[model samples]
Target: MVVGLREVAERAGVSVRTASNVANDFPHVAPETRRRVQAAIEELKYRPNTAARQLRRGRTEVISLVVPEISSPYFSELAAITVRVAAERGWTVHIDQTDGDADQERRMILGPAGRSVDGVLCSPWAVSPAELVELAAGPVVLLGERETDGVLDHVAIDNVRASREATLHLLARGDRVIGAIGAQPHLQNGTAELRVEGYRQALESAGLPFRTDLVMPVRSLHRPDGAAAVTRLLEVEPRVDAVFCFSDELALGALRTLLEQGRRVPQDVAVVGFDDIEDGRYSTPTLTTIAPDKTQIVRVALDRLAARIAGQTGSGAEAPLDLVVPHRLLIRESTTSVRTRKG
Candidate 1:
């Protein structure tokens, strides 16, 4: 009782080739004809067999999403959104995690598995842009970072702007002697560089000197890194009034360290972080952080991959394809007053 392509083509008054063209979204088909074929296919509930389609088209009809750390809520949330979006377009998502390891990332890009996917959407923590560009044999979409040379479709927030805005928010509240938890080479994608630029810009704008000692570079994007970074920052500049963490996880770690050190948040020292994560909202004292449209970013990323898989191309075609979403400050209890009163 299954419907076939020939039945749908017959109902639409089109040849099998014409129906195939409509399904593949081949250009040059008349709009009216395309509409009729689409309508007939929908009415017949004709689900194209992926294996048959692949055999005919020489494609797997699969898009791969490569991330550095799947365990991180940020990446996992993004993956979830990407899957949902791809599913809507009759596409499937293949998720691969590299655990932020460079060798694993290299293998993913250079290995045969990379070639099996029709398109790729990735957040490279260990792979360099140059290497990514070389490894990409097909359409590649880079997320969570800036696009280099229009190498492929990209969807991201401006890290520099987001970081600067977060720093400025703290500065606006009269915070001086600001501290920042930075990332070392252990992390990826020049994130630390861009964020540091933002922090420096904020300080420059406020006529405050950029103190190198106040920046503590951490080895990872975990709570332990935050804790260790805080310890170093306090020891280097014990009287620091504010701290900006590169991520919410680090901020949580810093929060734990501050509590253990008997320093009250927003009282002894104010703290702010990037990535307005779920845990940040429900922390002991809610975390003040920068918020980006994560869901929207993922949605756009998946749509771009789908389009690329369907052979769509060029800038500003079919949709606003390349995206750099805006970021906003979400103030919370963690970053309140700039000054504390001694009783």
Candidate 2:
């Protein structure tokens, strides 16, 4: 006998719609009710009719997850959670890497124009805000911030605040003459800009003057880029006692270079990074960094995308949904010993 949602609902003692909501991984379901529905589903061995549902809804039930580089530890971790969350929803995800290319990002953003993909979840690097508004075809959810003025949904932590907190931590521990790595002034995504802004905010709040030479802009947020930037900072600002890197990859690279240049971690120079990747935890001195709740970020973005796919339209539909998730600064062995503040 062919099993359907009705049987599951009956077993779970919930309405068919409630069972469907649970099956679809739609938010707002009570935890206990959802548990019962899921239990019933397992007991009945009910497999959802994805194809039939797709045909009825005219949806491919697939979304494109575009990122600059999937190999980047931060993006890789983020993508892993995204895939898992999307799978629970009975949806498929197509991973596309643009490598922060302008043309590639443009294609991913506009590719879903009545195409196979139902929506797009993109962490764009090069696409401008004007281009995004103009090129957006279907329900597109940005994985980062863009200051798009209600033209897009932003699922991210407050980059400025996170960056500022990390910087302030180092300052509180008596590390002065701190330098920041990772500023992409040429990009309009605003992620890099926001992080740098936070760094500057922390510096200003501590009565330290921001210097053009102390902030380094990078072509990319990778190990080598971080290494090169730190080398430059050391050369330009020889008295640099600490550094704030924008990404764990950069921080790792900075740590390597700092070691190569005969600087000791936290003893001579304290370092902090963002995006708490796994490698940071095992590095020689370990990395002090910011940890964003990746699971929350993925789930919220997918939930909003599902609503959009369901044709969310109303007076407030055009308003931007900027959800700021939680983030915390993790102090690790990299800053185990605070550098003595010079009198």
The estimated TM-scores of all candidates read 0.79, 0.81
| Candidate 2 C-alpha lDDT tens digits along 1-343 | 7778999999999999999999989999999999999999999899988677877777887988989999998999989998899999988888989988999889877875346678889887898766786887788888766465667887889899999999999999898899999998988788988998898899999999988789999999999999999999999998998999999999999999999999989789999999999999899888999999999999999998888877644444556688888989899989885445456
Worst ten in a row by lDDT for model 2: 311-320
> What stretches of model 2 exceed 4 Å from their correct place?
1-56, 312-316, 337-343
Residue range 143-246, candidate 1, lDDT tens digits: 87645555556788888898999999889888899999965655557778888889999999999999888888988778999999999999999998989999
Off by over 4 Å in 1: 1-53, 110-115, 186-188, 312-322, 337-343
Give Cα distance to truth, residue 333, candidate 2, Å: 0.7
Model 2, residue 188: distance off in Å is 1.5
Clashing pairs in 1: none
